[model samples]
Target: MRRRTLHLAAVAAAALLLAGCGTQRDGTASPAPPPSPRGCPAEVRLTAADDGRALCLTTGGRLRLTLHGSEDRPWTPVTATGGALRPVNAGVAVRKGDAVAAFEAVAPGTARLTSTRPLCARRPGQNSCPGVQRWTVTVRVTAR
Candidate 1:
């Protein structure tokens, strides 16, 4: 009788071990996928100074970008010129997707809201120098 009891216990232990072996097998659920790539990949290339960030290399000194006002907002771009992005003018409202007023950080880093011009531009020369409202994102710059 005792021998039979020992045999039953061993069999149960083996079954439990086998069950755990397949826990991570095909029967288990798969992990989630990584984030999708962005339309305009946020990156910047350089020559001598690499700060542990992404980059791009080019020959000519041409540029690549298309400034767009904030999504639904109505702010305009004044003078975006920092890191890599830029704006055409310097006297428009500060919209969401609109270009920034003036950027000058020519490296790889974040571009959050530094300053902003919230309310309507009612003051005197607010039309000429539209105040900034918020910084958008980290702009990578490839020195020319």
Candidate 2:
């Protein structure tokens, strides 16, 4: 009788563990997908122009991104995912103006571009820069 009780308890514990494995903290079965960009289609496709707006891209296409900011609040591209995109040129400025940062879509895959800028005052010789603002955009590349 003791052995039977122990075996039943072990089976119950295993069942409970398996049931909890696929649940999220909110008790949902699966995580939600990322939100689609506003005014964009639900399906992935290239936009008509590369006007720095977030949109999907066709494989082997080109995208032109322009980052603008003042000298004290300069923005810069931090990273890009996948090998489908390559930067053409990038720059920094002290005054508000357009800085062309172009990229090319090399292959069919999803990619992300991230840029950031300082939003708070910085002291001399300080290692850490606080109040950093980040901008991230997702791009889907589809084969033609």
Per-candidate local distance difference test: 0.36, 0.56
The sequence of per-residue lDDT tens digits that candidate 1 reaches over residues 4-99 is 999999999999986444123443322222223532233322211111223232222222222343353344433333434432234445445444
Point out where model 2 deviates above 4 Å.
1-54, 89-99, 121-129
- Using TM-score, give the best candidate's number: 2
For residues 15-125, write the lDDT of model 2, one tens digit per residue: 998654533466333322333454223233222132233456666666655566556666764468888676655443324422345666777677776677787544467
Number of residue pairs clashing in candidate 1, backbone atoms closer than 3 angstroms, sequence gap of 3 or more or interchain: 27
Count clashing pairs, candidate 2: 1
Model 1's TM-score against the true structure = 0.22
- Per-candidate TM equals 0.22, 0.51
